[model samples]
Target chain A: MTTSFEDFAAGQVTPLLRYATVLTGDPHLAQDVVQECLLRAQQRWARIGGLDAPGAYLKRMVTNEFLSWRRRFKVHSTLTGIDPPTPDPAGRYDERDAMLRRIARLPRKQKAAVVLRFYEGYDDAEIAAVLGCTQGTVRSHISRALSTLRAADRVKEAL
Target chain B: MNTEDLIRDALRRQADLAPPPGPVLAALHRPRRRRKPLYLVLATAGTAAVVAIAATTFSRPTADAPPAGSNRPPFSTVTGSPSPTGVPSGKLVSLEYAPTWLPDGFVEWRRSLFDHGWQRTWRQAPPDHSPSAPALTFEITRGSIGSLLESADEPANRTTVNGAPGVYTDDGLRWQVADKLVLTVNLDNVPDARGTIRRIAESVRPDRRQIRVPVSFGGSTRFTVSANSRDDWTASTDVSYRDGRYMAMLHSVAHVGSSPRTVTALGREASYEEAGGGVLTIPLAPDRFLSVGGLGLSGFQQPVPVETLTEVAALVEVDLGVDLSWLGV
Candidate 1:
């Protein structure tokens, strides 16, 4: 028997929304991303309904959306001669929160590679699949992302 | 100091924010609105059904499962028994690709998405050795619509479609249009059985006029377009609108490698020339409309008249949230 889209979505939307929020940093955009992801998933409920891990597919979509948004932002930013705005300074927040925010502020690929690697605990191969790049590229993204993070950390410490 | 520690903390924070109760289930079953496009229905049906099955088998707990360790939840659980939600299962399908039907003069082509599954990628048909020939392209992707399009190498533009924000970009080499509706076609996979897929892909084009959607939504709209038999490709849209400003959030798919029957059953088939080869009207205002043709096209040009359309008109309501005046063109 086929499952109802509403029931399946009811159980999964929250976690997926959470995933989208982390990827996009903006709550509204996150909601938009989740909405788009879930909406699309709803259309294909009958087919994808049989997948081994449906959340993996949705998560990939969320990541792709976040990547797309970042690319668009970069294009617009380039046209306006604006680099991504500097991230706000870490206030009384914990070091981990501060570090994660700093990581979030990196270039799209780099940030995703880092998040998929360290935070999501995905190995290099897994990160490669999610990011749709060669494992070497994934490693490179992680390397660059971490270097940027570590550099920022040192700078923060000096400040 | 390991990177995983930092990443996990952030991921946990992200997981904490969930969709509000009650609305979550409805949001998944259908778009948050009433009206819908065929493509949305196919894609959503595919996704929702897949998730439900996965949840049943994969979410089962195993006592001896691996520890949660540095990760969290559902560690190495044994697969469970089927808890079918009872939605009718459509035919298991495959998409096809072929290089010959491409008109003669197109410069280059590449396939972005292809696999033996319900989804297929979109690309333009090749030009017939004519410089003025229009580009042809199609896309069949299943994730973030924004991400699927923006990741391409071509230059894209950010603009609003009928007031909804989106990106528009293309280059002469190959073209891609990704948003709620994606367009682009590849030449390598069409089988003899998939001619209908090619025909549908050839039919997609950009539209000039704007079609209005008449629906109320703080909900969602799920739309889909698929390629089926040699002479048939079907497109569908479904919306689940809740009370809100956005009529319905839209999602669409253009399948190029499946049979018409398969496409229709899956909800990915679309009719681009239904209302003439320019605009495929949704028949529901403030509800949905799919426009194909004009300045909005990329790749080898077929008839792409707004295949998956949606609208979110701004509403001016009083303190009681009752309608005062509807604001939108």
Candidate 2:
């Protein structure tokens, strides 16, 4: 049976959009990217609908779109002045918020790898397929991201 | 919490930021906007004429051309037409080399131009929407090929491409096409892979056509402009000072964040941010925005002032009517 594009998009758009949002750190851009990918997917639904896991294919498309979007946009910013989240009246800070900001500043592939592992619960092999890279490269990206985050945590503690 | 737990928690929280899918679904059914092509083909004028003359003069094969299946470098420098504005265009802005032929049924589907080099991909069918779908990709870089066998699980075999030394591994073929240029061709799930890859690599020649972009940067002569474009039709031109302390980027897509602080620029309201670097985003249309800002590369240097960014933003020219159907979504 050939599944319809509308039905596929109905079931998959939420997860795809959520994944893109975390990957891009910008919801509006995520929407644009997801919508673009879906539109293309619709044009080729006859073949795509026949796949065993169409959602996985769409997810990979979103990941690739975010990766290429960074290159096309080419917006460069420094990492020096990322402001910490507001402190509570008790003088405590939200470390999660700070971590999110740091994640936002990671290089594109690293951030995507981190998101795929932590959010999607994807193994290195799965992430590798989505990224169109080797499993070793995927591990390297995640390891580098963790190192940067840990180093940032240490600096915060010292401060 | 441990870093892993913290990352998981943070990502879960961030996932809520995804907007509801109603609008996206609605947009899918709406009629797509149609626009005339923005590219101006002045084939008989200015740099186009020069390119035409050069191409004709260089049409004959060089006497030293390597024989078929010979292992030698087959590339010769070819000049392309320049943009009318004297902005670097054509060979200066496009890929240095492109395959003159491909196996039957292969079609060029995507190309990305960057500051240093470009990448082009071809596939057997257009309907393969999955990113992991089988395709052939050709990439050129401005630096060393850098350990062609670095990622090879098996020992790489030394080979030749058009008489030039190359390394062939399970992953792909890599060769130094020129002193500063390296080329790699990757094949995935293609029929007769080895012979096809060799034939495609051997057919590479100088391609000097200027890539068309949806927007142009006329900002300042003091800043050198580096333009890049993607197959999706989204393009950007980044202008930076020689010292790299200040820069501005103009994109054909809007990148506004939530609850952005608003200010005035170019007689219109714009979203502004001073953190990391001063960023001024002015909406060009419902779907497009222009961003202009730069940060200091050195620790002691400060970001460009907001006023300067506003001035730079004023100098951008955008074409809202450019056809964007290729964006796929």
Candidate 3:
């Protein structure tokens, strides 16, 4: 039997929130994105309930919502950009922590692509599907993004 | 540790920084609908179901195996298992190509990542080093090299090495090896580097240590993914049958505002208009049809041939993620 809407929501909302947090890099924004998407999702519960992978379906919605937030909500009026995690003193920290800061500073699509590639363990094709572009484009975006993050290493080595 | 492992750890740590979601759970109330369902049963089914879901915990949903007969396999908090887009588990080949011959007093100085690939540099001895020092740099790009659109500006000379086509310049040489790799050499102020660059380019052979996969174009250029509905009413799917090369999108609609010509697609009646981002609509169920768009797209955007669109409609087996069958009804 298919799980009811509330049961599905109750069971799945936390993970959705968590994924959103990681995606948006802000817990509050993550909550907003997830809540809004879920509100929209509840309206289509019937069609969604019959789907083979309802959770996957919902996750994709949240992802799109997060990706398109700038256009959909006119968010640019108030918020210029998401605040990046603060970098530590370069000499004290290793590449991993430094890379983490550089990662947080990546542009939205680039950040999303990198996260999907490295953190989510998705391939170029999968990432292209998620981010809505060609695999070649995904490869280009990932390659460019990672190259920027490596700049910190060059600085570290020079020191 | 590699970049992948380090990134995974960092992300998980960032995820840990998120405050508890307990408040969000307590506030999970369905929005009120403006249009009441024809039957009271419909209007209240969702709110009606909330009481039953009260005991459910906001933990992992796909922890257990789904009941048998389900097309989907068991899932976890991780990504779905059925995703065909598998990340390459096999190691990528990492090999550096160094020229067999270098100018006397030249020392191998740097090996680092270059644009879309790797590069190795050799700087001349300090006695030869002035404000302008001669150096040799070889860049080998490993990803999607064959797709590089030929440029009109380069007065590039066509050249080949070992049957692989390349371009040669006075200063250096460039090669697109085996359609899977690209190697370009630039003589950055280095004198008498042409002969060495050509030798290195010609001597370059497939490496055993490099990550190897059966190279094929049929699969790499194609992709299939289930689209998630932006909302309940709108339903759509895009099939990149040739991956990035060609893309076809189908949106659910009952009918179009303008008229169209009817044609047979896979023996079923279909309608298509060829002008202005061409659209082909095929009747799937009564009052519900799949409208395919993204036709006649030029440049990098592959035009979806009408026959390909028909074939896609004919071959569609299941509603990928968002069930389009219920749309536009």
Could you give candidate 1's per-residue lDDT for residues B1-329 as a string of tens digits?
45456556655544332222112223333332335322221111001111111122122122122343623222111111223232321111122222234443433321111211112222334212111223233343322224323544444444333333334432211122333233334233223313443344445454322111111112211222222111122222222223211112211222111111211111223333311112222211121222222211011223222322212111100011111021110
Cα deviation in Å at residue A57, candidate 3?
A: 2.0
The stretch of ten residues in a row with the least summed lDDT in candidate 1 chain A is: A75-84
lDDT of 3 by residue, B252-300 (tens): 3233313356776544566764432334555543323454443111111
- Model 2: per-residue Cα lDDT over A44-128, one tens digit each: 9999999998888999988888787543322111111122223446432356656786787688899989999999999999999
Residues B14-81 of candidate 2: C-alpha lDDT, one tens digit per residue: 76445334335444543431221111000010000010001111122222323569653222111222
CA deviation > 4 Å runs, candidate 1: A1-3, A71-97, B1-4, B14-25, B28-329
* Selected candidate, larger TM-score, 1 vs 2: 2
Q: After aligning candidate 3 to the native by TM-score, how far in Å is the CA of B284 from where it should be?
A: 57
Give the per-residue Cα lDDT of candidate 1 at B329. 4
Model 2: which docking level applies?
A: incorrect
Residue B286 lDDT in candidate 2 = 53
User: Which consecutive 10 residues in model 2 chain A have the weakest lDDT in total?
Assistant: A73-82
Q: DockQ (C-alpha) of model 3? A: 0.09
Model 1 preserves the real interface contacts to a fraction of 0.22
Candidate 3, CAPRI quality class derived from DockQ: incorrect
- List candidate 3 stretches off by more than 4 Å: A71-97, B30-329
Ranking by lDDT: 2, 3, 1
